[model samples]
Target chain A: MPVRLYLSHVGKSFTMHLQGGTTIPVVSGVDFSVGEGECVVLGGPSGAGKSSILKMIYGNYRCDQGQILVTVGDEIVNVADSEPRKILQLRKDVIGYVSQFLRVIPRVPAVEVVAEPLILQGADEGKALARARDLLTRLNVPERLWGLPPATFSGGEQQRVNIARGFIAHYPLLLLDEPTASLDAANRAVVVELVAEKKQDGVAMVGILHDQDVRDRISDRIVDVTAFRAEAA
Target chain B: MTDFFSDDPLLQVNGVTRYYGDRIGCRNVSFQLWPGEVLAIVGESGSGKTTLLNCLSTRLAPTAGAIEYRMRDGAMRNLYQLGEAERRLLMRTDWGFVHQNAADGLRMTVSAGANVGERLMAVGDRHYGHIRETATDWLGRVEIEADRIDDDPRSFSGGMRQRLQIARNLVTHPRLVFMDEPTGGLDVSVQARLLDLLRRLVADLGLSVVIVTHDLAVARLLSHRIMVMRHGEVIETGLTDQVLDDPREPYTQLLVSSILQV
Candidate 1:
């Protein structure tokens, strides 16, 4: 039950030049948190700044005002004012992000995609390959297709490879952008179960989702971003 | 397998068998999709739902089967028999496909409007203004804000990109729209809204659709009939209500029961 992340009064804005030259408020005074091993589901209408919040959490975009305090273990790091390099380091070693669009490495087999993070993190090549293979096997990305590049795989198979990549590293904080959007029923269930299983290992997850049924199956805490947007307006 | 017929079968899969060196993808998979009807193909990841769609779209050649399409001039055509030029023509004019990932169906670097209007340009509609208007109309039909049409699809949220992809396909108003997990990447509220938009658009346009999804909830919401596949084969095919409510097969029962409603 330890605190893993905390964002207080986060405000992001943009300066828009009108006929009279004025500024517009895009997001104002948003706040939420995730604890160690807890999942916070963020849902809202399109353009409600759902992805923006993820960007803020991952330190991609800077907040104009307020503080974002992220707890890595016991120490609380103030991300609002932290240097970009510091944040980058934090993400590389501790944060695992799965974008909605799969970023495939051309000419690399599906199994190698999952192992890339591990290889980057300095894990032994053989060991990393072994773990990646196990993860793909568990997620049901067929063994025969492991050698084939993800470019040839179907939408669901590509997504499975992406999931394997995100979870293979086993970072404490996993930020997923619609991880199971294209999967068939069986693959979707496997993803839900996989996340639920990982939660037992004390990983904190924040994901943007459109599937309420899938959300209910895995989430313990749901943060409705639409409500936040309405309040801001 | 039981036999059935539709008034105008745009997609006719007869004795379709696909295998990868003896690992079965699907066997004797047969179905008929008529005009204006939404037939859903439901299965898990390995169930071969996508394989069937790929074979029909001619993205992948079936090992042993024939995919026949009834053309506009009261003539039946075999899609596989066509050469590269003819196949490309079918993709441009006769068929539309919306992949689960919006990026798959769309060019991320281009504006949303261009992504929707590419098919138009491919078929020789070079008027920029007309293409823009049509793109805007389809975007509005899918409930995306018209103002964002000029923005690169790379900047759009997942749900918005998906809507744009649907708009991109439907702007051509093709006879058959094959959707693979159209709402798979969205959250529940987003999914509900997207499903509502799809239902309204499908009803209004009478667009024939074949959707592949793992979500039975989606099947119940949008499909007129459902086809359940397991391990690359169709196990059950019936009306959505009948199959979902009273599945005759054990695998179907498991899939139905596993749905955790929010």
Candidate 2:
């Protein structure tokens, strides 16, 4: 299988400039590679730096050291050191991230939110909306809520809307951060089926699934993050 | 990734700085606006977002820095270096500025039809019949009734007047539009409708716009990228969602959080 994403010796930490410049180390020497059509789960307890690794891969957080290389067509770009513009371009064309919460844009319909990514990629408006409607239906979002903004939806409803939006567009490498955290059994099963479809399409996925059943079913390999724990000085 | 329709920016501002007698109005601001893209300048009042917008539109000159615009002839010219007559011609033909106060942008003494037709006249359209026909078409496009075309803007309500201002500006098919709080004075429901109309027209016309607004919601709905200003300097700039969702700067984070949630 072709490797879609690779990270080696990756490290990250936070500095409290207000608190006398104290450096708090988070993770170090994190090494992993996810191949096409494979779903790799980051397994560990809380505070094990799983989310940070995902953010680094998505170029949301700047990694302190080593490489976070993403395969884009024939080019390999390092997210850790690339310019902000390059990372933004990579995000639009290569990576897709589904964060835990949905950042709602006011007055935009829920269906438009899901259809926006496809539209930004130059898909026809009618076809994008059709696909968005299809995903929203599959995820069991109430039909009445599709035309309204997701801001007022309950936590679980919002999560499903976020999932529908995330899964609407096809990305070669998708990063999932607690995507199913608020979903119930039926919707969680839908997500699992969605993951299977992505794998069949040869997408490489890295996710943090705390739900053991879902994790066990989808993960081809588990990269335990405890080994990458950074020691305090 | 490769745009076949000319990757060159439509407007470029390099280190633009303005001073109001030693106190900075805006300082060292720089960014590029591509064709068919909307860039929002967002900050609290006194943050110099207005100053930057004025400088970009040539309504106000900067103390330092250059503002270059790509003309319809495909030549880049420094706005400050252009002659007064040429600048006026560009303002009437290629550029449009929508003020926060509708009265400021419109002629209260003239009928809404005349308000929209005046720009056509400025650009050398001589046929009165064709100009009035186009004016009526634009009034309808902005959701104002065609019957309202003959009424003066002073007789219209605030929202109607604002919509008329937009029609007047857009009637010329300007490539770039500068909006300063275009939805500022309207009611919530009215603002939503106007924003919907503006979004459609912007997309349909493929306009490049630089809009200054204190409302983050307006910024999110209209802009592709956002530049957050603080004390006359750009504090942080990024993709609109990235800046709003995961702001890196503490000030930006506070601004995003301060938005009233329902």
Candidate 3:
């Protein structure tokens, strides 16, 4: 399998003005990558710019310098250098992201949440709904909860729903930040096994987690951001 | 263990049940926190671990139970029976809250110093200099660098923010503390460091704590007594070392087995 997500000399930073016009850089130079069917875990202390890497991979933030190359199926594209139109298409068709905070649209049913990615990618309503139901069942979300809104569910259930949304369409690359943080040992094992199952289906993943158990369960490669920073220093 | 509980428990909860409309939060949940002891509540999400903490800390009203607090005035008062003003007074003087997300428990807009000092200010410590000194002192105790006292919490990393939140809660010198997964968002190394800090703080302050977490290792590291909850009921409860080493419950055994330590 080839590399699905690649970053070479990736550096992301934001400038902040201080009391007397002094500026501070938030995220310094950082580099990492992931391949098809591979799971990478990024670990670091808080404020070490871990979340920034995910955002950059998902096209939410543009890097100050360096490039991010994402290859899926027959296409290879530079995420950082891509035009806005191409970036939108790339995110819509190939890249999927589950944020640290499970941001479900309030009052929207879980079925709708899962199916929205397909709907956004221009799939027919019936086909998308069927796909969403299948994904939810595979992810172990109860059938009765399908039409119910995410807010009615507990933290762990909501996280499962979030994962379902990102995986329902079988997008080539998946980015998850603390996806299993709310789950207990039993449920976390199920989710980790599910991620492995998805990887066997050729879905690539990069997850950020503080839980070493979750990290050990899902990761093929571990990237220590704090250690990387220290070596760079 | 008897010598540990020689003095009366600082906080006693009995037959507690909390509900939201038709939904049950917890039922017949009972526990006691003696001074200088750590009691960990381990449960999956929706197991009512957090609700139990809320009821004990008087943050949530229990529909069917009583939380008796041995007050400084040498009188025992049921927390649920207290009036709003009385609850407010109790909150200011006796208890502290550390939420799962440090950002939720902290005022992110404020500097770290002000965040810690807010507790002192709440309890009527009006002297700015005194508040600053106390805040700096507690921050250092929690292993947060003192030079970052004036930095906004937004600038701190996840681990540092959690430490700052713990410092904020501990600064008030509350006899009883409640923490909901204080290390949930931190990396493993940071979690170990924070656990070490908490162990030291619990020993030094002699503060009784009810910490809610889903991680068994966290329970092993910080707790003396462990309660395993499932579906809003206590499935098992025992000494941390004993229960974790030899879990009797099938669910607990399953939970223990799923952990693949490297």
Would you list the C-alpha lDDT of every candidate in the order shown? Answer: 0.79, 0.89, 0.78
Candidate 3: tens digits of C-alpha lDDT, residues A118-146: 88677898999998898788778899999
- DockQ for every model, please: 0.01, 0.23, 0.01
User: Which lDDT tens digits does candidate 3 get at residues B79-183?
Assistant: 878899988877766777888799898999999999999889888999999999999888888778889999999999999899998888888788778889988
Give the top-scoring candidate (TM-score).
Answer: 2
Model 2 chain A is weakest, by summed lDDT over 10 consecutive residues, at A14-23
Off-target runs (Cα >4 Å) in candidate 2 are A8-29, A62-66, A81-88, A106-109, A142-155, A230-233, B1-6, B127-129, B245-250, B253-257
Over the stretch B74-97, how does candidate 1's per-residue lDDT look in tens digits? 688898887899888878887789
Clashing pairs in 3: A46-B157, A46-B158, A47-B157
Off by over 4 Å in 3: A1-233, B1-3
Per-residue lDDT for A92-193 in model 1, tens only? 567788864665534567887789788756689999999999989888988999998787788777888888888888678888788878677887888888
Cα deviation in Å at residue A4, candidate 1?
68
- What lDDT tens digits, residue by residue, belong to model 2 across residues A19-115? 5556778899999999999999998999999998998888777678999998988999898887555666777768999876987766789999999
